[model samples]
Target: MQVIATAGHVDHGKSSLVTALTGMQPDRWEEERRRGLTIDLGFAWTTLPGGRTVAVVDVPGHERFVGNMLAGVGSVPAALVVVAADDGWSAQTAEHVAVLDALGVRDALLVVTKSDLADPAPVLADVRARLAETSLGDVPGVAASSRTGDGVPAVAAALEELLAGLPAPDTTAPVRLWVDRTFTIRGAGTVVTGTLAAGTVRTGDRLALAGRDVVVRGLQSLGQPVEAARATARVALNLRGVAVEDISRGDALLTPDAFRSTGELDVVLVHPAQRLPAELVVHVGSATVAARVRPLDDATVRLRLGGPLPLRVGDRLLLRDPGTRTVHGADVADVDPPELRRRGAARVRAADLTAGWDADADLARRQVVLRSEFVAMGWPVPSGATEVGRWLLAPGLADELAARVPAVVARYRQLRPLEPGPPTAVLRSALELPDAELVAGLVRPPLALRDGRVVATDSGLPEPVQRAVTGVLARLAVEPFAAPDTEALAAAGLGPRELAAAVRDGQLVRIADGVVLAPGVEDRARRALAAVPQPFTLSQARQAWGTSRRVAVPLAEWLDARGVTERLPDATRRLR
Candidate 1:
């Protein structure tokens, strides 16, 4: 299915052309039909010449309802630009064409309406000449009179050809349906209507709406009930868990976790030479919001929205100066922009964005981004980006962080002489990294991870503490299993605090209560036990180590905990 929106001036036979093509009345309000003017949006669909169904969104052409017109055509991919033969291009005609051009709608059919009143050759030539300057350059034109039904067949054929030329919608893309109308049903529930731009919407699918969630109770396409619907089709969703009063026209139904809501954005102006005001009304999809603009350069500006919207990079927005009734377009460069609080920050940022929406530049600017967010923002992972677990980092970021780690560790050790290197969290904070997992990658040679902290290969201990610990280690080396008593340790000036510092320095290993041994005692014990018979009892192990029963019991348990030895049910042990 293909959707096309009507764009033209008031009473230029837009609704009349839609009615003639669809064979259905587009104007729903009686006042609009009575006044012969379209006040709001109207919808109608028809099967074209090739049996391809096309939905037409008839938008109001009056200057007063420009907001409503934007809402109707915001998501539609194609357009039917109507120009009356009797009245050549008017003010609204140029404005509507400017809107279509700003939105980058290229698939269009130029229709010269009311051909019976005057010869449409002059008007068709003039309209085509004006459209050639826009994005929809030199579109197919057909002069049709809805009153006499003359040339209607050719108009339908032109629309069919235009729809055929359009690229196929991506069904696998995330769903973002902009609601153009919301109403209530008596016995069923609340219903919302919109054009499903992409992705498949199925019954029972839960979607996000204005920070809340709602379930799709049912689905309909062109007034027919359907269990599932794909993109480029007009849809009406029966929603559960939300009241009709809670939802407005501009609200969007989104795939959960597929978007990020942001109040500030950086955009590259489509027309950089035009002078803009401080404030403008911004329109994207069906959403319209007031935004304050701060010029970063001639090409880029930052927009602070009145409320948060689910935006992404590469999205196009129409900016309208309400005071002057002028409209232009902008391309979103960054949705989650950095703050510009420092002096000259905005100028530097503008220089960064001056090259225009490059994915590699965006990755370099952010340094690190979650993989889900990078893809969710509608960009493929760039070629040079590095993938670290669930994150995508800028190219060569790991090497840069690794280069800064040794200096950080040296400063930390200098502050506290008796301790080892810094903790992972501290190192992460010092580097200003976003995740602690990144710190592990930054550890290079001469640095080892012990337990959960980073440490150097050699002890970073004080001179006095090193002297005391050396004496204890010399004695333990001769008598490997014979740990000194507390009185003996104190006499050597190695008290509890001093022993703890030695343990952190990797000079001593504290196994159990009143039992502190040399760093490699466990390896020595394993070597001694390996020579004994299989499944030796605790008594036999004590005699083999030539140590007291206290040291034997604790050492055996520590070996069991470290998987160095396995203890049997009968109080026997064997080397694992």
Candidate 2:
């Protein structure tokens, strides 16, 4: 697991404890060493008694640099919450605890350092009282003084127990890593270091670095290369092509299909101080995004953002207000973003926390339909749990519906094989589905859509009509050499409507009034009209064909539609 920095007030000896334990000075920069305060996140590692090694992130303790502290603690799961043995619970301490709680840090080991410098009794009491208000209050605190190494081993032991007991962060969950640090090296491309917030990262995986595809050329933990990493592991990834100038302190590295970039989101903003957000800045993990708050309740609010960001439907992120022009606000919970909203307001109530998945079958079905629409259009899925719990389509039934719909329609058509098929009500009666349901699901084109009446794409003409159309076209291929006649269609044993339906099915084409043709009839009609050798008058035309105008009109029109003969204004037909 990846380790992150501790939280507490200044001079709490977080750095001192880290130095005494890991024997590596956490103050890296020259100014920080002289100032004797950890102005940034300090990184170090130590081996526990259980033979498992762990990494530690020492966050800044000063209130002024809380944004940096949040950045340090963003990706870590279990934290080492430090408090001075003498000063007890300070203001920064409370804020740090709040940050930890908001970030959803589940497992943490408490450490009350500087036991020798001050009386431990009253301070420990205050510490416990302070812990009572947060998720980590139940966690045991180890008292230690970095100077004499007193209780250092005890603290290490407690940490080992905490590590062993630490709940394994869900690797199967969608991945989100907040980029805390971005730098470049001589040989490698841009290397971004951060904690793996959730899910797993493997070699050759393509991740959306700050919502853009960034190649993972390599991964490192505690300054050494590794193949794969899981949640809560502090890692430095050698990116393939992106540059350092493109990214900075507060960008997130996300799994492409696993997460979505959203400008609008639903959030539960908590101003533990009860201070409302006027125009506060939101910090999630290491990256801070600017957003405007629309509060629903004391604990819940909606954060509308200023830029595009990758946030999964169920994932959590921290929020903050920029204390300084270059800083962030206090942390808040990412309760899931509001539904896509444009030019309108949505109300999120207190019950919204347990309410996102509050969907029934009908609602879930709608959600699934909407989700399917999204998927078909190539959009991100909300979540499977959300789908199962609150989607408009429930129980993976949409997929089942997608498969069942086509099959049911296909089978229905098979059993009723007839010309023009059945009407909407008839097919729906056969399927026993509502009109709306059938229309939305099965009857919508290109699968099934109604033009004049309902028609399934898979529906075909009746067998006899198909055979009749075939024989008519075959006969016309020899003598008439034109399209089949509508009046003579009875010659092939089918009615005009059935013949028309066959023409619609591509068996024939209706060229003009009372005239129809099979495929390639136009070319044959031209040859026949040419062989007639002369423009015959009405009588000669009728006599030559051994038929009256009733048969001749339809036949002549068939030839006319095929451009074989032009009927003159004086009733004399001519070869064209």
Candidate 3:
């Protein structure tokens, strides 16, 4: 599927051309049909000769409604720059062309509408010369008359050709549906319609809207129900958990946590007639909001938006002055930018943006940067770059962490030998690292992460705890199944803290509360039980081990828990 928006001056027959080609009315509102002008976005689609479906977004061509026009074509990959042969070129025509060029729209069809009124050859030549200087310089053109239906087939062929040459939409990219229309159906719930710019949205998928999650109750492509909708197609989503009044045009439905909405952006202005005005209307995606511009250099500026917008690096935007009616094209260099707090900071930032990421900077100073963002900014990761999940650490940061973390863990163990080594959270905080994974990555050989705590590979009980454990082990070795009481063990130096440390360090194993045994003591008991018959009673097991019932009961239960022995229904025991 492909979506193409119409651009031209008012009364230039953009809607007429779309209607004639699609055999469906482009205008939906009665007022637009009565006024014979498009006041908002209109939708139409048709099947090409190759049986490929193409959606047409008919936008208002009047300069007054250029905001609405921008909202329509902001995310559409292809466009039809409409120009009437009778009225050659106009101010709105130049404005629309400037927007398309600024947006970096390369796939387009330059159509000369109303060909029956005058010779299209002159108009085509002028339009071609104008486009030659813009981003759509190499785009093809077609002369068509929507009223008489002449050259309409040629227009369809041009659309098919334009789509064929364009690259396929990335269905795996994060979904960012810029809402152009929002309303509610009588039987259904809230419905938001927009061009699926990228990624695939399926029914029942949860989408982020205004910082809240909304499930896609249903999905439609070109007015027909569908299980899922892919990019470059017109999509209408029946949303749940949101009301029609809560959502409006310019609001977006996006993949959760995949994008960040920011009020400040660092951009590279392509062609500014002069220094931008203090305040301008910034248009990107399907949004138009007032912004304050701060010039960084000759071709770069920082725009502070009136509201937050979900944007990314490499997105193209247009800055139009409402007072002077001037437009400037801008390419986003950074979405989450640092604050310019000192004198000459803007100049420093401008240089940094141009030079790209600094390889020598500390990871703590650089913060977390996604690998995808680095690729979008055209900066490859420096050699030996450390990555945690999808984020890349600054160069040399990993080595620095590797050098310091083991020492930190050793110091922590020295202070609290009775407890496990510092937990993952504590390690992250101690190092001032952003994520726990970085701490985990730093834990190497002599240091290991276990049960959410970082501990030395050869971790053992302290001297006092080891002395206590040694006494307990000797006592248990004399009588394997006969465990000492807590009071007796404490008297022998194995107090509560030392006993816990011994267990944690693998010097001892606790079979039950207040009952401790040396490591592998259960195995020795299991071997003695195997010497008995296939099935034996409690008295027989007690006699075989030469221990009383008190020692045999707990040992039997512990062995049962370990699956070393199984108790039968008749009160008999056997090896499992």
lDDT of 2 by residue, 374-441 (tens): 33222345444234221234455545544555555566567755444445565556555434344344
TM-scores of the models, in the order given: 0.85, 0.68, 0.85
RMSD of each: 4.0, 10.4, 4.0
State the local distance difference test value for candidate 3. 0.85
Give the true-structure RMSD of model 1. Answer: 4.0
TM-score of 3: 0.85
Which candidate gets the maximum lDDT versus the true structure?
Answer: 1
lDDT of 3 by residue, 1-576 (tens): 999999998788998999888999999999999999999999999999989899999999988898899999998998899999999889999989988888888888999999999999999999989998998977688999998999999999988888888789999888889999998998898999999988999999998999999999999999899999888799999999999999999999988877778899888877744567889999887888999889988778898999998887777888888877777888777776788999999998887766652433323346556766654443446676788777787766777877888878878877887886999988888888777877766787888889899988887777776777787788778977677887888787877787777787887888777787778877788889889997999898888777777667887898898898999999899999
- Model 3: lDDT of residue 226: 99
Question: What tens digits encode model 1's per-residue C-alpha lDDT throughout 328-435?
Answer: 788988888899999999999999888565788888888988989987776789988878778888888978988888888889889866667788998889989888
Ten-residue region with minimum lDDT total, candidate 3: 356-365
Poorest 10 consecutive residues of model 1 by lDDT? 451-460
* Lowest summed lDDT window (length 10), candidate 2: 326-335
